[model samples]
Target: MTPDLFGRHRAVLPDWLALYYEDPLEITHGEGRHVWDAAGNKYLDFFGGILTTMTAHALPEVAKAVGEQAGRILHSSTLYLNRPMVELAERVACLSGIPDARVFFTTSGTEANDTALLLATAYRRSNTILAMRNSYHGRSFSAVGVTGNRGWSPTSLSPLQTLYVHGGVRTRGPYAHLDDREFTDACVDDLKDLLGHTRAPAALIAEPVQGVGGFTSPPDGLYAAFREVLHERDILWIADEVQTGWGRTGEHFWGWQAHGQNGPPDIVTFAKGIGNGMSVGGVVARAEIMNCLDANSISTFGGTQVTMAAGLANLAYLLEHDLQGNARRVGGLLLERLRAVAARVPHVREVRGRGLMIGVELTRPGSDEAAPEAASAVLEEARAGGLLIGKGGGHDTSALRIAPPMSLTVAEAEEGAAILERALRSV
Candidate 1:
């Protein structure tokens, strides 16, 4: 049965589209943290569909809201009044730190980033963009152009003249040997030198934690230091919070708050988890910049009422239950457990991340060389043990990514960690 489905998929889908596992299972349904494959195998989901299922799978409140909204109205273009869309925008604007903030919704993170690029370029009057090394923003042309990771970026041609900068992944770069303070100082110096060498860029776009780059991050205030340099030159700062937003990191509501010395960013783009599992993405920026586009514009299916309704319900649930606090508490415990598990594993290179967004990088024993084979082995073993996880990294995809739902419980964390420990040991 799996082979027949795989054959059909390969015949219809693009070859570049990738799937997990040696024999991929068709996930039939999910409830809370557990999902059942077509073969009637139940597995605990740790990756949460690339962190898109922020709250949980089949959340009753979100499902009810979506159903109700769909029954009344499916979609209404930007030409008409959309109450749900307006309400969600207002809520997001109030939460966004940007002063005089305005929100624009899109259908996916890629479109949100595309809109951000459009706004930054139009506002600053330059097509040049600054991005970090080993970053993965999206799959769009503009997003790919700015991506410093060669694995995800398939083409060199781009509409924007993107200049890749230093200091996204601190452990693998030239300044990895330095202490945290020295690392930030070196990255700042590099940024200043790069600025001096190039034309004034429209914006510097970056992910707070490079999700696909093994969840790697720099020192907390590194971006704040760079912000000081960018501010002097009137270059905009664009934060791509698709994977790091909505308190996924546990410590802060927004990842940028970790580097809040320079105040809020000029523009912020978000998607993935905002709508729980629904398709909702958007950009929030000061009105002056959001309205900088001279020509009139509208996203045809961007803020359809159904998706907005789902988003509103999901956001309300997250806030009312204080899921951010839950994430901090549970994710803290989970990180400690994973760190303990990593210590006994010979190939585990590093265990890092905040809150629920954790990463365990696998490398050759006693060396920094990435061990992609070990990662693949662990992934397959975890599945055999009834636990589902994710794999990603710029260094040959050797990191095990474990970003479960924000509402994960302590018991679930322990259960998942036990399974992961066995998987690690087996490899």
Candidate 2:
């Protein structure tokens, strides 16, 4: 980015809104998985605008759908009947696996999570919520209140009382040394013990794969074991799939499916990828819980024609092309390559994630201590090497996030992995 543009951005935008690079690039336009900066430097976009571009950059199908819909009507109130909205909702309800599923649209993931919190608290008749450590829900007051990551949680004041739990991260925390089964059992035991000491909370909200927590996740069926306990107490299980949804996780269509023995989560909140860059977020729940609200509420521009049209097209393209399978095949290859690279690099603590959503944690040269500075150096090096990635961790922000578009080809993956390998070693 030019100094003038950077100075203008700092002068206008909030300081809390973070930028990626020391000299942040103003992206001019993009196509496929490549984006060009204002300097006309093209970089392979591995971050996919923080995983919002689930399909590809400037996809023709999505653009055509948005253009057609915009040519007709731009905005429509939620009070009126909307064909595109209803159609997209039907698709979502069918895809959502929740029986008697009802979909409520919101403009962003934060709003979707807010709606989920409202329904859970209203139905369960408790303002208490259970969340996992190092989890990120969103930025709104209600969303941030439940967030367990101190870097993301800005305020201590909140309307709901929240309790933090274990089992989100597998290789950290006190149980990191245990095997998968013993680790899971220990987390479940901890949960059971916690519930014994407190009132029944409204719900347990967790990202099946902790996105911002360096893509760390517990052993499979851990949630199912927890569900066995929560179900006995009538505590709802809510899966926050904002970053892990839309087949990005490769092995599972939904991140929660890795622990599917207990059946689907009672409530699921999603956003960030369904519209392929358009603002689309929603909550899916069973009819009883969704209809438990006493008063009417509507999202003014939640299901606008333009956004829904783009969602429908993107969903169709994603499904028809079987991008999920592509992610599995190509992402498996990429993960192995990055792991091989990590094996040769000492700064890398671990490389973990499934499918397109991967994270490489960095530590100090010869210590286990978190290295935020090393992470920043890798980001700058990766950008200079013509690649764009992201970083996030519990508090120190020492993990490199690599989630490209689902349609990323094997060639692109190889290219990105090479760039990333160079960045990791160079840093």
Candidate 3:
């Protein structure tokens, strides 16, 4: 008999790790945008494993690449020549839009952002970082220090001083009622005012779309405006594209592309989806900035051959299939469907997002107060309805996150939307 240690694994797992649902799911396998639990219950996976499965689950191209590479070699350290890593790096550097770009690989988004912080601080010679309010970067010390959300931030202990800035969330804060142009101006004015009092800082890092912040984002061109201000002051701009990169947003190949008036950011960090669920995270920057450190550095497992092969294949599939276009069409339909449902549901705050990345904010029926309980109920309800979704918010967990695989079809979107409608209304 098989040694089924699943129960023991759960019991002994770290207390810090939060499992979803009252009865946690055990995903045996997946295909396309659907998965099956240990009990063989099928679920239309709207979250796509937190958007890591960018193209599809069990993608044949990626699987073949991984298998072929693993059979040849698995763990060649970054110290050696890795062809797949180099190939993937070339593609990312070209796509990043940063002139004279250099690429560095890491195993996770936390490590990628940590590396970017190191590059910015070292190159600019300042330990200070500017992050948007209600934004989340990662869980590392440097990453968490710059995170402006209270719920996701676990500790205040940080080596660098992080100044919280505005203009990340469009539908919240004092400027929520303002129009797009007015809101942009207010946030810019506030940013200028903040800069006047503080000492010189290294960079202003932001996610064009705040993933864990409930899929929130400022109006278009806000970051370009911010970049203009930062440029004059010689402050670097880092776009944390961990969740928003690789055409997930539909209208743009990169989220920062939507704010291209001032051109690309000084640096860009990417992860989650490029590998189609493989652990692949990296930073792209101007060669000068990336090469600023005099001492030598290399990641032990950052660009392992196997992961790079998977990423190369997955990225190829995404580009070849024009899945970005699919995301645009399917996601627009899904968004419209959800919005129609939200219009009828009293507690539904807003259905917002572009492409496959969408968020439905839940609130109390009669009040502006965050209704996390409602969101949780909706999540459980969706699961029971044979759909899997996720949740986050500027407020403690009041937004439902919907990010199906990029390959989600029109029929699947309709099916998932119908299930979600019932879940939201019932909850």
Q: State each model's CA lDDT, in order.
A: 0.93, 0.93, 0.93
Worst 10 residues of 3 by lDDT: 1-10
TM-score of each: 0.99, 0.99, 0.98
Residue-by-residue lDDT tens digits, candidate 1, 1-427: 2899999999999999999999987999999988899989999999999999999999999999999999999997888999999999999999989899999999999889999999999999999999998898889998888888888999999999999888898788799999999999999999999999999999999999999998999999999999999999999999999999999999988888898898999999999999988899999999999988899898789999999999999999999998889899999999999999999999999999999999999999999999999999999999999999999999499999999989899999999999999999998
lDDT of model 3 at position 264: 94
Instruction: Go through the candidates in order and give the C-alpha RMSD of each one to the true structure.
Output: 0.8, 0.8, 1.7
lDDT of 3 by residue, 142-206 (tens): 89999999998999999999999989999888999999999999999999999999999999999
Q: Candidate 2, which segments miss by more than 4 Å at Cα?
A: none
What's model 3's lDDT at 180?
A: 99
lDDT of 3 at 49: 85
lDDT of 2 by residue, 207-318 (tens): 9998877788889899999899999999999999999888999888899999879889999999989998999999999999999999978878899999999999999999
